[model samples]
Target chain A: MRRRTEPPGLTLAERKRQLVRDELGDAALRLLARQGFEETTVDQLAAAAGVSRRTFFRYFASKEDVVISFIGLVGEQIVAEVEARPAGEPPAVAIREAVKAVTVEDFTENREKSVALIRHTLQIPALRARFAERQDLLRDDIAEALARRQDLPEPTPRLHFAAGLGLLAFAGALKHWAEVDGHADPAAVLDAAFTEAGKAFAL
Target chain B: MRRRTEPPGLTLAERKRQLVRDELGDAALRLLARQGFEETTVDQLAAAAGVSRRTFFRYFASKEDVVISFIGLVGEQIVAEVEARPAGEPPAVAIREAVKAVTVEDFTENREKSVALIRHTLQIPALRARFAERQDLLRDDIAEALARRQDLPEPTPRLHFAAGLGLLAFAGALKHWAEVDGHADPAAVLDAAFTEAGKAFAL
Candidate 1:
């Protein structure tokens, strides 16, 4: 078996910066867990991570941003995946595949941490608001990808709306799976939602 | 044929209060149209309506509240209508009927104002955030109502998620209808969305 390691070819500056950001994120989450979100300060986080306040600012704008920074990467991956789907695939299928690819494998890896993050987000009203805004941005990105496909019609707002709702269904399913005791796998829950949504449409 | 007049049982105090709120809302919208949303002030609205600043606060907490007050009323009506649906109807059917009833009649009478409100809400960032929050509240309300129906199994969160998405589809259809140049009735638009959603679900 081969051990996966960071590529050896990176510039020193780029590698150091990535390492610093990772350290800062780990410190921030640890602080968030030990001391509540409201109690944790940027200065404290900086000290905990062995980084200066200036370095902390360079990495993250604030404590809230530290928690949500991963979403941007997730959003980019989803857009790429959706765009990469076969040209004539249906909009819903493209969206479902994108959501599944991003969430199932990604969520499974950090199931406990992700659930804790969700609980933390729900408890903090400000984080909750920002999280919802992030979701909206992701929805628009998905919608744009769907709209740009040559297979879709010119007035694609309705299709965009439907696809966005489908995404929400998957999100809701994941939330349920995380919160409920002995719940099914998040991916299975989302798959059921998609299937149920398809059945409801048929009615 | 008889000419309809004000009902004899209507109270003078109730009518006066309503008249004042209407005057304030009208003045607020007119000012918002002339100046931008940020430029408008509660005092200016009060002066325009010939009411004291105290009276303005009594009616609305802030300028943003004025734009969203109507939506609050509509949301309450939607929840109530959904809860009132016959016992035998499925959760989705009840939700669809409730949303249809609330939007169909209101849109007919207030088409122009509704469009203006939608456009204004979209343009203002604060208003847009509030709009999203309100939608979240509406989703919860619909989900709760669906949960209460005994015909369904103890409502899982996925059911609520599906219902919430259905409501969003209805809302998205209405919004698109308002945007188009010669779109037909909003009710028809909602019906089409419901039909499409049904088809999506294979319901």
Candidate 2:
């Protein structure tokens, strides 16, 4: 049996790094919310976070990168889940399962914060572009995962199809969930979206 | 039977306007090809095209918008074809036919130019963002067509699914065709992609 290597559970150094990064991101978001994204500067963000100007650059390459810091964790968790699915599952099932596994719990846990961040990102054009780029990365990662499955057919169109559909479900669910405030759990909305997709495809 | 309303076959005034737009776009492309996107400016483009600064702004909102001028026509043609398909066809089939109708002769006619344009757009960040926005428009049009089909179920997930899948195939085919120096016609590549999608989905 293959042993699963878990993510290094936050070492002291790593935990400190994450705390600093989160503080910086929170400061950036607060500024963006108060004074539009275009008006907010790295200096303001650094000062708000109680860090040196250099520390902001240490955490993020650009202001746009800071806006999407959460995506790195989301991407890692989705890829890890996809990689860990049961052997011999079909590509579509595997991708869907992976997406569902990551989103079901995470989205529920951070519904309010997630919605707020999404609204902020959507309102800012540059941040929206970065968000799309992040989604593209996730799509490519899913594609790569599908490509590596030996049980799948050669030149697997299902790989792209599955990944694309999974993303569509994610985007559609997120949009719908954001539109309705205090309606239902975001995970349930995602489940319903997936159920709708499965029915649409008659899977 | 509903009578088709063609776009008034370009009035003389419209023809003159199109001619100027094309000339300006060609001049801009020439500049872009030589000097690269970032180094080129609207003033330089206006001078190269023999147009005033005001006229340049009238024609294109930005340099990035100029790169995506052809997309509006493509979107119109695709949506028209989708809406014109024989009644009672499956939504996916209608979408496939719609994409086929627009791409077949149009893409082949301008094969080299299309490939160069796609390559340039992919290489430029601003152009790629505009391209993605245009693609989102195409997806919305496809979704609208799918939603209008009486054969599909209510609150249709298939519309979203089919639109997303169709765009993915279109993108994948375009990238593949551009990579190969436009050796094969883009329409044929897209057709093959749709066929592959059908097989993948067991549709």
Candidate 3:
């Protein structure tokens, strides 16, 4: 049950690069949420984050890549959270907790921001296409992490299935949360989704 | 259960239009499968289907739309199958049977064609983007059909969840089937995905 407060080891240069990337993500998300993704420009993103246009490119490939990198960061957190779970924890429980930990954090006070960002990501054709690809990669990452935690050399179908189900629950909850215009706590909605899935399967 | 052999009482003109559309879909799928989506031209598709190039636009909006229309046709069949299920069937079972009936028909002897079309659809950026949107619309359509069968005025969260899960299983099975280069029976793969979900949820 160890929690990662931060990565343990990083050179000063690496840490500085990580800081710049995080700053860009923060700025990009805020700008996109407030101004609409279609209208936002790379210059605006760079200016908002106090970085040059060249600096932004050094960190990310495009405006869309910034949002994707943000998602990738959360995915890495979920994997780390899963890896840090107790060895004896059930696979489902570990995945559930790991997903909840990362997602709930994203939706806390920044709930509306996250919702707007997600809406843009889903509604915009380019982002939506990338999102599907990201989901697949994230699912594999979760399954691989679960395999590692269980001391298995390779991920099994069962592990992949569990990862997929976890993602399904996450997606279902997000859909519900967005449908309600983010009025409900996403974490609570997620729990209900998991419960519904549990009940349906229990039969 | 009444299986619809054909839509009852189409005008001769309507039937003619339907035949032309189906012919185009068949030709488009075949050409796209063999020649690659990017390389295939509308002229070639029209020639193969024995139709004027202008008639292709009469039925579909674009090359990609032909593939989407093909998918939409199958989605309609899925909804119809779900609607036609006996009233006493459980929601999950009804959805499972409906999806299996329609999808299995699709993957039968035409397995390789399906595999190629699906691969092209997934691998091509424009098609992949549209596919994600199509999946969303199809989920709602399935849920609405389920709700109608249950005599509800609108679909419930449970029904939507059920629909989402069914699509998730279908997608997973498709992924597995494609991974094996279509060597496996898609229906059996789908059944395995559903069983795995049931086991995971039973916990």
Candidate 4:
């Protein structure tokens, strides 16, 4: 439901192509959640998004890729957000804010649908494997972001560990949030998880 | 390469069964590492271990299961080690010791074969997925271990976060160890990773 801005430098064709890609992703998530991930077909996704099957293929290689691509996009946004965080912030705080910027802001307005989609994604083995793969890349990107934020020459082991820990906290919080049917604000749960992690580490 | 004690309560037949299972796992790892995972078949594994194909099936459902069961056994042993840590040790230190007990002690004399098997496991998609799935269960078991150590009724969110963070550090350290061809002592790298994690969390 979050509307992403088309870059101002994009020409009409480029901007339209981006819009169509987003439409397909949106339709894919909805259909996958409603009809079930295993049951959803690529043709149905293309039809629902008002794009040709060929166009869908152009944007995404397969149905699994459609969902995986969305996750990849979110991961990239999270890394970008981390890089954009003010340099003075603590590493953990910056990482937390980066996650919050992408997930909390986007999901707050559509908690029910977000919860349904996340729950569905976790249930499918193919998606879970893909998610794990994306998570490995995401962790590395976060470590690099932390290094840049701290003005380090490159990511150190400590930075990588921090990145991994921060993401682990987020995952644990998200799992709990989804399990509870999103009754509590996702942001609050996430913050609490980070705070708990801080305490655990401090001990 | 690690030798496990048969539980004293087991009958002679049960002890023999356990030994045969261990033999198959050992043979599977050696064959999978030397010949490649996909290239190694069940018959080869059975032959290498001096067991019939039917007997191999009785012990393990498949070649992947042969590798995964070794991982599962290691995880269980780690949990048991955690339970056996000195009651007064700090939680992180205790968890670290638990890992050293299972991994450092077992792999020290067998570093080359361990590294080869680990590297191969990471390269195979099916094995990687199974590893991720096993990791999830392992994390939960670790959380339970932490909870029991602290006399908590159940695994708190903080406990789960700590378990995840601990495992993440181990994974990052192991990746580094294997990357460098295991020239450095695995325990030393693992310890440094945990120390770095401790510092990162404190920040």
Model 1 clash count equals: 20
| Interface RMSD list for the candidates | 3.3, 3.7, 3.0, 2.2
Isolated chain A: TM-score per model? 0.84, 0.82, 0.78, 0.83
CA shift at A75, candidate 2, in angstroms?
A: 1.8
Could you give candidate 3's per-residue lDDT for residues A1-203 as a string of tens digits?
33345466756667877888888888888887788777988999999999899999999977789887667778899999998888788777888888888888668778777787677776786676677656766878988898899899988777776776677677778777877888897778888887776554333
User: B1-203 in candidate 3: lDDT tens per residue?
Assistant: 43345467666667878988888998888788788878988888888999888988888888789887767888899899999998777777887788789888778778877787778777886687677667767878998998999788998777776776677677777767877788987778888987775565444
Give the lowest summed-lDDT range of ten residues in model 2 chain B. Answer: B149-158
Pairs of colliding residues, candidate 2: none
Candidate lDDT scores, in order, read 0.73, 0.74, 0.78, 0.81
Tens digit of per-residue lDDT, candidate 1, span A54-165: 8899999767888878766777888888878776777777777887888787677787777777677656866766666566667677777776665454425555565666
TM-score of the second chain for every model: 0.83, 0.85, 0.80, 0.83
Flag the better candidate by lDDT, 2 or 3: 3
Could you tell me every candidate's TM-score relative to the true structure?
Answer: 0.78, 0.81, 0.74, 0.78
Listed in order, the DockQ scores are: 0.21, 0.29, 0.24, 0.41
Evaluate model 4 with DockQ and give the value: 0.41
lDDT by residue for model 2 (A104-161), tens: 6766787777777777766677777676666655777776666665545433555676
Per-residue lDDT over B6-103 for candidate 1, one digit per residue giving the tens place of the 0 to 100 score:
47755677688899999999999888878978887788989999999899999997678889888888888888887788867766678778888888
lDDT of 2 at A41: 85
lDDT of 4 by residue, B41-109 (tens): 789999999978899999986667887776788889889988777767766888888888789867778
RMSD to the hidden true structure, all candidates: 6.5, 5.7, 6.3, 5.7
Better of 2 and 4 by TM-score: 2
Q: Tell me the TM-score that candidate 2 gets on chain A alone.
A: 0.82
The list of candidate 3 runs beyond 4 A from truth reads A1-35, A38-68, A122-130, A175-187, B1-69, B121-130, B177-187
The most accurate candidate by DockQ is 4
